[model samples]
Target: MATTDDSFNGLTEYCDECELDTLHEVSVQIRTESTKKENAQFSREPYRVSECQRCGHRTSQRMNNA
Candidate 1:
């Protein structure tokens, strides 16, 4: 399972409509990718959906683990 941290919790993003980095609500969707290897486990990726609390502006970003 993917856990949300303070950095990517959607409150730090800049909202164009609000013209600032304001509070936002974040929703995460987990996707599993199947591997062809015989003993390989599936890889999990999370897509973050964020909506501005003030203006309801929405944006999405895929999380990268590196």
Candidate 2:
């Protein structure tokens, strides 16, 4: 269960420990990345991080800012 005061975002995901689709706490984070070429330009990318409420299993994905 999520409380209004604590729940800013929530995501539905499958948890291996739970073995079901459960609600997860969601948050956005910025990660720095650079190419492995000679001119390696650094860039910050936004990622969506979700943590399972039951098992605390965490996963991250690059956010589609489209």
Candidate 3:
């Protein structure tokens, strides 16, 4: 399970419209992992859609819940 205190430090990517790399503000976040697994130690796959804080450019990415 992911923690609330998880760091957002290394989660940035390039924004084409902004013409620079900027931190994005998360617009939507969804967890796509099954909760009915036999083992309780399974990982999670989170889908996130964010917008560039500088130019309002939108992007989507899948995050590893390691």
Candidate with the greatest lDDT versus the true structure: 2
Q: Which ten residues in a row have the lowest lDDT in candidate 2?
A: 1-10
Better of 2 and 3 by lDDT: 2
For model 3, how does the per-residue alpha-carbon lDDT over 1-66 read when each residue is reduced to its tens digit?
111223363245577898776666664475545667664345455677777767778877677645
What residue runs in model 1 are displaced by over 4 Å at the alpha carbon? 1-12, 31-45
How well does model 3 score by local distance difference test? 0.61
List ranges where model 3 is wrong by over 4 Å: 1-12, 31-45, 63-66
Question: What are the per-residue Cα lDDT tens digits for candidate 2 across 1-66?
Answer: 333333456756677778887878878898766766544445668898888988899888898655
What's the CA error at residue 35 for candidate 3, in Å?
20
As for candidate 1, its clashing pairs are: none
> All candidates' lDDT scores?
0.71, 0.74, 0.61
